[model samples]
Target: MNLRLYDTAARSVRDFEPLQPGRASIYLCGATVQAPPHVGHIRSGLAFDILRRWLQASGYDVTFVRNVTDIDDKILQRGTDEGIPFWQVAMRNERAFTWAYDQLGCLPPTYEPRATGHVPEMVELMQRLIDAGHAYPADGDVYFDVRSLPEYGALSGQRLDDMQPAADSDAQIKRDPRDFALWKSAKPGEPQWHTPWGPGRPGWHLECSAMASRYLGPAFDIHGGGMDLLFPHHENEIAQSKAAGDSFAQYWMHNAWVTTSGEKMSKSLGNSLLVSEVVQRVRPVELRYYLGSAHYRSMLEFSDEAMSEAAAGYRRIEGFVRRAEESLGMPESVPVPDAFAAAMNDDLGVPQALAVVHDTVRVGNAALAADELVGAREARDEVVAMLDVLGLNPYAPPWAAQSDDGAARRALGPLVDVVLAQRAAARDRKDFAVADALRDGLAASGIVVEDTPAGPRWSLAEEI
Candidate 1:
């Protein structure tokens, strides 16, 4: 495989070589499930989803494990605020995240392990660290001795002395302020699991390490998450896993955040655009195209204008695909264009790859206009193949069902016809101004009115 990826640990683009031949193992740090996912939250999922699709397209058997942090401080807090059990809070929000992922057409992971369900694995990993003298228990809590590992700060590229204290636990009990908790001591009214040290819950960073090892083994091809997790979460995972004498995460990949008003979109910042709400304004497939259109490593700034522009851009490609299929019927997907594959191989360059998609769309549109069946069919095949790699194939399952739904068109027909009748009456009376106004109004609402020789015809605008 010629695929190369930007490794966060190496701080450079590196050639991707799977640990095992013809197989790729990826563990993506998934949602914490404290609340419904915002667009910012789902961006990471979509970014990694593209990677998963590309790997499969490239002929690698991929094992993708995306873990859920079901038990966390925020989850507990949300439960308290809602007057419900923490488990209930976690489950409700987890479903929301799952829905968001599915709505955007993200492929489900090979194993979606929850942290609370894997206590036994966490306990075993904690025991290994303790026996190896890299972790110790104090006051019913297990803490990883950060100084024990000489290469502790390698992942984050920070010197031990310059680093800030690990704020995961109280400084009074830890031997060093930098030591992070493997297990937090059980607190009143909180969930707990029995461990040799005491009854407590797994720490945030510890959950991922244990879950990744459980499904993908100790040494896997890649570990991925958002850029915000690079400091404490991913760095801690690296220290604990390596200190336990395991070669974990051969390559580290972190996607950039979705920002709003120059700030990272977060609930605390009060700038998050929820996936459910955003999809109400735009089609789910259009939202997916907007989010995945940018490079995975580039920060995508959110704006209504930007999103509208992206929707228009996607509509152009979809327009060509639909037109070509009408002229040439459905074409079998051929291998992706060389330019598209080359861009994808170069560190998942979606921006460049999308350029290839648009270029093909242009070619297909020209072929259709000239009534060249052979050229149109070839372009359609290439376009479908490229879109499939990017997980944006409109003719594919999910999106196809969405596109072919007659119920919506049927429901909308009567209302649209009423308006069309009024417009026709105004036109018959030579009230051109009123008729044009009504037609423009319908177009603004994404309804196109065509005055044909047979009769007036109405259809939903493609851009919407």
Candidate 2:
């Protein structure tokens, strides 16, 4: 099956032909670890995750690389306020992001190269640019010479003459105001590493190039991130890498930013919905469905009302899969429809693919109702595969536990005895509300409180 993806380069959809036959290489610019993930953060990754799923489903070996930016101006600014090292802030937020990613069912990347972990690679890349005369070092700071790269504005479609200088420069080092930083010379108390030039840190655009090249190679199949990065961030990456004599990304993919109240969601707006808080309100799979229901280039507005609407649509798919599974007696066979393949092949049109799934359910349900068990069997199999491809199996409950935690619970030792004593005291005093609330709260957070015949035993709920 041919995979058609929307390439931001062409501003149109095109068939995806891997550089290496039957394989894919992808580099996704990950979050800067200054804050935890919000709904907006997940949108870009989940969109590409869907693309990864489809490619794998079509028998492509996928190597996905997502980089973590540990060193940033924001982390330094916040750290200065808190009186702690900026690296500490980065580590704390990186763990928070890992939790958010797991809650949303995103696959772990093959390599999660932290920017701080790859300074040597960054120094090497900077040297290539400098040696190529595309970058020049002045006053210990290395700046990319935008004029040296003729195709600088080709990706962003912004000409150098039209770009206004962001801020007034010192007027001594930079030949053109349009030139951006490749490496920043170390300032006192800032995070720094010893480089060929001096002690300094890598710039934002240079980090991705170094990390991507180290993991995936000089050229990869696709590079994706939020549409906001299409400008200076990704454009600089293209300029810096090509100037260094390495072919950068072959295909560029950018998903539209998630919006709220008719505006793009951003930390600066104070309107962002954190992923952890959202997971508390809406199930992860439901949230995924809501975020992914529209075209990748379209803005997704999320609210309680929007979530409820998505749940309604998702419930339809869930209801169909559930009924089909029950009535068909777990049929092993499912027929693939030409319509299903065609829809997916057409720029990965999820909406059209969904229509085929629902159509299968319609015919599958009717056949089951009429006792046409054989026809129902084929439909059931097709629905299963479709759900698998979409990462949403309607029948699976949202909050299911995937681990056996009984041994760890038993190892609590003295804490378990103390809790048991408290439970007995609560029963004797008739203060059942505290006891009940404790049990119920645990159950709500994916812990199942079971009043077994022996005693109160707790375990994890079924993981969806």
Q: Pick the candidate with the highest TM-score.
A: 1
Give each model's clash number.
0, 5
lDDT of 1 at 165: 57
User: Where in model 2 is the C-alpha error above 4 Å?
Assistant: 168-172, 329-336, 394-464
TM-score of 2: 0.84
What TM-score do all the candidates reach, one by one?
0.92, 0.84
Give the poorly placed runs of model 1, Cα more than 4 Å off: 166-169, 408-446, 449-458, 462-464
- Candidate 1: give its CA RMSD in angstroms: 3.1
TM-score of 1: 0.92
Residue 84 lDDT (model 2): 96
The residue-by-residue lDDT of candidate 2 on 1-464, one tens digit each, is 57788888788888898999999999999989988889999988888877787788788999999989998889988899899999999999998888877666677888999999998898999888888899988888899999988888999888999987778564468888888888989899888888878888888889999988999999899999999999989999988888888898988999888888889899988889899888787678778888877777788877888887887777666655655665566545333477877777777777788888889888987887787878877888888778766667543323334222446666753554566567657867999987777666666666665563356655544333
On lDDT, the candidate that comes out on top is 1
